[model samples]
Target: MSTVFDFAANLLGGGEKPLADFSGQVLLIVNTASKCGFTPQYEGLEALYRQYGARGFSVLGFPCNQFGAQEPGDSAAIAQFCSLTYDVTFPMFAKVDVNGADAHPLFKFLKGEAKGILGTEPIKWNFTKFLVDRKGEVAGRFAPTTTPKDLEKEIEKLL
Candidate 1:
């Protein structure tokens, strides 16, 4: 697939949903985990989604266990944790590998569009973020350490 809209992913506790469902809206796609040190970033991500959702922006979270085995939970458990712990209300997808032979196609396209440091395509850790513009273009990539709040300006720019 070319643009992210060309791809699809299984939503947590739901059927597969096309990325096109978010077409025309700016997107923040994140590889999330439940038990990592960065797991608390889920709060900031939810904040951003609540603050900008009405402005045609959304956050898409994909739980991943590839890093440190931090997200070792099934769909139901993940959904419950995100909801009860962080009050996360954003769209969340099933667990996926962000870097590997089995990496999701959307992530493969995202990495190719916005490589990390030294133009590396591999995701370094959990919470790695890919910002997508309204046109479904991968606009920017943020490291796992980059908090969701730090992305406000860029998200505003896209909005």
Candidate 2:
């Protein structure tokens, strides 16, 4: 019975933000990295957000350094990079571990809800995305190779 709303994580700005704040909206939750090759996907994510934000859809970004130390920056750095580089305006959270023993509870729950290729659960790389429906149920999982723009159809279906 635990939806994403049952979890809370620190905002990139410095406070705990309940996932409940995003309840009733279809969500595309992504584990991001700054220096990774897939970093440019931020533009596509922002595009999706801008295009569908008014329709009860949102893209929540979480910076993660767990992969190749690609995101080795502090909250301020991450926030600035996102704003200045990609003009991202979506809600972003503090850095979090998306895999291993210390993975964030919300991510652990998401992984369980949407297993990856061949039923694998671990996130393979940065830019991993999980799409959630309005009811907070995880609808799909996308690998780093799956660009954000490529998910528009599925996102539309969820909306």
Every candidate's CA RMSD: 0.8, 0.6
lDDT of each: 0.96, 0.96
What's each prediction's TM-score? 0.98, 0.98
Tally clashes: model 1. Answer: 0
- What lDDT score goes with residue 154 in model 1? 99
Put down candidate 1 lDDT per residue, 1-159, tens digits, no spaces.
479999999999889999999999999999999999999999999999999999999999999999989999999999999999999999999999888899999999999999999988999999999999999999999999999999999999999
lDDT string, candidate 2, 1-159, tens digits: 989888999999999999999999999999999999999999999999999999999999999999999999999999999999999999999999999999999999999999999999999999999999998999999999999989999999988
Prediction 2 global C-alpha lDDT: 0.96
Give per-candidate clash totals. 0, 0
Candidate 2: TM-score?
0.98
User: What lDDT does candidate 1 reach at residue 44?
Assistant: 99
